[model samples]
Target: MNIVFPTLRNGLFGAILALSPMLAAQAKTPADQLIVGMSMVNLFSIDPANAPGLDASGINANLYDTLVKRDNGNPERHVPQLAESWTVSEDGKQITFKLRSDVKFHSGNPLTAEDVAWSLYRVMKLNFGLATTWKAYGYNLDNIQASIRATDAHTLVIDLPQPTDPLLVIDSLAISPSAVVVDRKQALQHEKNGDLGAAWLVTNEAGSGPFTLSKWSANDSLVMTRFDGYWAGPAKMKRVLVRHMTESQSLRLMLERGDLDLAYGMAAPDIKAIERSDALQVQALQRGTMYYVAMSMKQPEFAKQQVREAVRNLIDYQGIDQQVMPHYGTLNQQPMQLGLAARLPDPGYTMDVAKAKALLAEAGYPNGFNTTIRILSEPPFIDIAARMQATLAEGGIKATIVTGTGNQVYGAMRARNFEMIVARGAERYPHPYFSLRTFVYNPDNSDAAGLPNFQGWRASFFNQQLNELIDRAGVERDADQRLKLYHQAQTLYDKQVGPIMMISQMTDTAVSAADVKGFTGDDAEATRYLGVYKQR
Candidate 1:
């Protein structure tokens, strides 16, 4: 799907006028409203516990507030939100948070420690995919209430169920979608069949953030009105209107016509064409998600280390990054994200047909092996897979590309039923421990274990040593020791020829009107619009 946008000197403005009549009528968006256009195909759920998509996180960021938030530039530091102050036990097992008394939920219920504790308990009780985060920290449905509880209306306490760094738990609280505090009384009032409002929250919200959900229609549009009683402060914009638009051309046209204040997921050509426009500003936000080529270990041919390494060499990383990933991602070979103290330099793996051929021969496949590459039928992913198919042919590997939706592509991987896959995922924040855990740690390899949360398990790549190193790194309080453990784990994964080979780190580009101010993209995709405003 190659799209060409007219150059600025070549009737670009005229093209905008001819394309969208609906948008042309409203050339200028409302001064007190922020209009955004993006694809909402993945935003089916907004329930904090079950909503795992980036779109839902962005929506929830405006609709809800967490106890704390990770500092944008510095992942190691966390600033308070609903929590006024918090302290960790010297033994590093207990944490206590003091809630702000003046805060009130959108339901007019006072936000308290009870609400905070109950929100967490609700996550464990529901046991959705998001529950994996707390489960990894040893919190379970049976033990969550006892472990995380409210001592008083103002004080909430958390007791660690196992030996791990208390900071990791704190970091999870700062970034996890399920960490947002919910109004327990309000949620229970709508509970059905003892679901704890799970069904209602799928489309509705029970939050105290800067905005309240005024209306939402799946795959249509969503409107968020500013909450006047917001404890922080009222948002500058009285309303936030997000229109669901999948066509990149439409997004570009709307943006060019001054109908859209901000647009996301536009084609690269559209973004590049408008990069130099005086009316627009483009920002590339680095996300923690990684694009990787994963081979299931369950596949007989890929179970061999030599075959795995051969497949790795057959990947055209340089070509993919230079040609296909202009606005989608940056070249990243390591499992961990960039700009972290614990991360190591990329091992510098490149496509080498001769090396791949030799490895395949050594693995008893001199005539090459036939395999399928499952990927989402979308930009960047399909492009990467196509590039891989061409390069793999050079290495004597006959691979066919199979395209499908997110559910088909990822669900197969999670079920450990695919030969290969090119997908981006698992981690959403730039934390060393979480990155390594998402990509490398698989405690149990049994199919009955059913831990799809870990991409490592999905690919059936389980290394006892790598798992131990990551587990140790998660618990080691000494910064130097933890860094060493992370380095060692990366080296071991390389030596083991791990099934998941990372090709790039994702970068989401947002093009907005130049007049839009205070619009910084959150690293975790939980972008809050509290301070956003039009300069005019």
Candidate 2:
């Protein structure tokens, strides 16, 4: 709901806009604290290897540091935090990191190589630790596992099976302090009810980050305070609070009314009116935030490629983009470019009414059948589902929408719950793999926090090719050949409607005017908030 109102201006550019001329004119005052607002949608976890959602992105980024955080368009490059520097072998398979011996985890112990090795060990074994990329590299277990080793107290060497390129495969891995977890075996002993290590990371801060974890309640709230001995100066804010409610209407009503400093997890249009005045600013953390619907390829309804194509054509993309979310997004024309299918073409699902009818006829479904689509009880998605139902109706398909909350929705999805779903997550940074293969390529019943391969379409062959693509993407020195393989895989994905993907371009945060300064985003979605500094 963007509005245009002319403001009195003498210059062509309109007198350098200022929300508050008096405030801008006044001398800058450095405050002791910078309070950040957390309305909802913040997941609690400081482990970069496993931090998920808006809260985690905000909290963990400040609390932990990754080995390599990207600057901008540049590939995932290294910047000092725990490791002051590192060197890659000529073949690119091995990476030798020189640690910053001065740094210590919040637990009060110095960072060490043994911890680094254990941390890698933790990531290599997904269910046991905070590392979340298990689905991304689950099949290629050989890439990790025993691949990492600590040669000395301060030096760590990683041996890749081949010349694994840093640009593609492993971005900067956020090093975990050995002082905190000590050993992987012992760490599992701390798990509550023997679920996984994520439980420990939720309320505990074993990281070498700027802030220390104090308390946490899932979907409710999390708290953190500065680590006094943090190698970096103490954080400005005395404490940080986070919550995880994803209600837009409530968030917009409460936050804009001044009850909160910031709010998220909801896509309320209420801010449009406020932004027209000087009372608010929207800080979107843009990277590659993608959202989409996936169909069960194994289902009889969607077994035919033509049926998938026809259903795609029936999507009211223009109607949705133009009507409901005029400000939120642009039409995503390809799947690979967004969501878990990064680099694949969207086909815009082309809004061809006749072609859709013809394809349906060719598939012997000229009089589209009735079907139900699954979705989260979350907003925006509910709206999206309804919109899809309406548009599919126009294509002779009767689409019923079924919605549920949390585990209920996830459980159904896991069991091949519905013919379709409007699930969220993916389009992460550092590489396309982070955005894609983590789900679509290896999605199956074995996965927990991964894509629901419930449709039971296990194209092991496609995934195998995907693995070759991953290795080549990282290690191949020839840019041309690397692109060739990338394109080859991308082509196969594009030609098939395996997943109905829609991408959300970086809408992560709004870079504030309050000197929340530093490079805010990159090819990978990570924003190194520690690098951000207030202007002196």
- CA lDDT, every model vs. true structure: 0.87, 0.53
Highest lDDT among the candidates is held by which one?
1
Over 36-88, each residue of candidate 2 has an lDDT whose tens digit, in order, gives: 33333324344544554434565656666555444444344445556678887
List the candidate 1 regions with Cα displacement exceeding 4 Å.
1-24
State the RMSD for candidate 2.
Answer: 8.8
Error of 2 at 470 (Å): 5.6
Q: What is the Cα-based lDDT of residue 48 in candidate 1?
A: 92
TM-score of each: 0.92, 0.77
Cand. 2 Cα-lDDT: 0.53
Q: Compared with the true structure, what per-residue lDDT tens digits does model 1 show for residues 167-258?
A: 88888999888999999999999999999999999999999999999999875689999999999889999999898766677788888879
> Local error of candidate 1 at 304, Å?
2.5
Model 1 steric clash pairs:
none
